[model samples]
Target: MLYHIRCKKGDKTVRTIKEVVGHHFVQGQPGLLMAHCQNDERVFINFDHFDFLDFSNGWAKGEAIVAQKAAEAKKNEPPQPPPEPVINGPGGAS
Candidate 1:
């Protein structure tokens, strides 16, 4: 879903936000962000930040990312031996 903030000031041309209310160090970039209008609060997080080990039980972080890239690359390559020929029987069903 998408939303337009109806109450915010300025025209639709506003493209940059320079203000920083606060800051906190995060191990990795955030994957999610949420705001609370009434409470004047916000949350940003990367769920994987909690524990690197927990993210991938037996694999290292770098290996996990690399493995995913290898898997994607494998998808683009053609089959090694080529596909086997399909033969149709003349009688009825084979």
Candidate 2:
């Protein structure tokens, strides 16, 4: 089961989890939801600040979201300049 977690205020999708297991902790009473991502990464999300989307039906939507995020990241990044030419010793010979 795939799941998408996002920030509620900005609606920005934080990460995509392929297999998810939700855990509830009542010790400190922070109301945190813990999920295990596809890469076996444990992610903690506060119910107050995040929203979850279940993509069990299909991965098309999830893929779309990922694509959108990639596009956004590419757009926001600055272009890189070419590296300077290396100078050799003596008469410019290697």
Candidate 3:
């Protein structure tokens, strides 16, 4: 889901942040937003610059917020251990 963050605050045009992610506002950081952008870039943008945020899939605010929470929760989880390697022996193809 690509999101368009428009900076329509002032009279002049500002850089529009676009990516395959819903707009995620950073916790504990007022006016700060995080976006997963093109080329697999994770960017921290100033929300103060942008006037609006919209998901390409037409996600409502609540849905996007829920998605953001889920994403953040996943990120907070500890990394899992790699699967044990398989050993080839006379019993083969185990």
Candidate that beats the other on lDDT, 1 or 3, i.e. the better one: 3
Instruction: Give the alpha carbon lDDT tens digit for every residue of 1-94 in model 3.
Output: 4666544444554655676564466875655667777667777766445554444557534454566667678878999999987879978657
Question: Distance from true position, residue 46, model 2, in Å?
Answer: 0.9
TM-score of predicted model 1? 0.27
- Could you tell which candidate, 1 or 2, scores higher by TM-score? 2
Local accuracy of candidate 1 as per-residue lDDT tens digits, 1-94: 2111111223332222122243232323332222222334544433244222122123333444465456567767888996776767876546
Over 4 Å off, model 1? 1-56, 81-94
- Report residue 31 deviation for candidate 2 (angstroms): 1.2
Q: Which lDDT tens digits does candidate 2 get at residues 1-94?
A: 5555443434666655546543333234344446667677887655544444434544333353454456567767899999887879867746
Q: Residue 45, candidate 2: how far off, in angstroms?
A: 0.5
Model 3 residue runs over 4 Å out of place are 49-94
Residue pairs clashing in model 2 are none
lDDT, residue 85, candidate 1: 68
Ranking by lDDT: 3, 2, 1
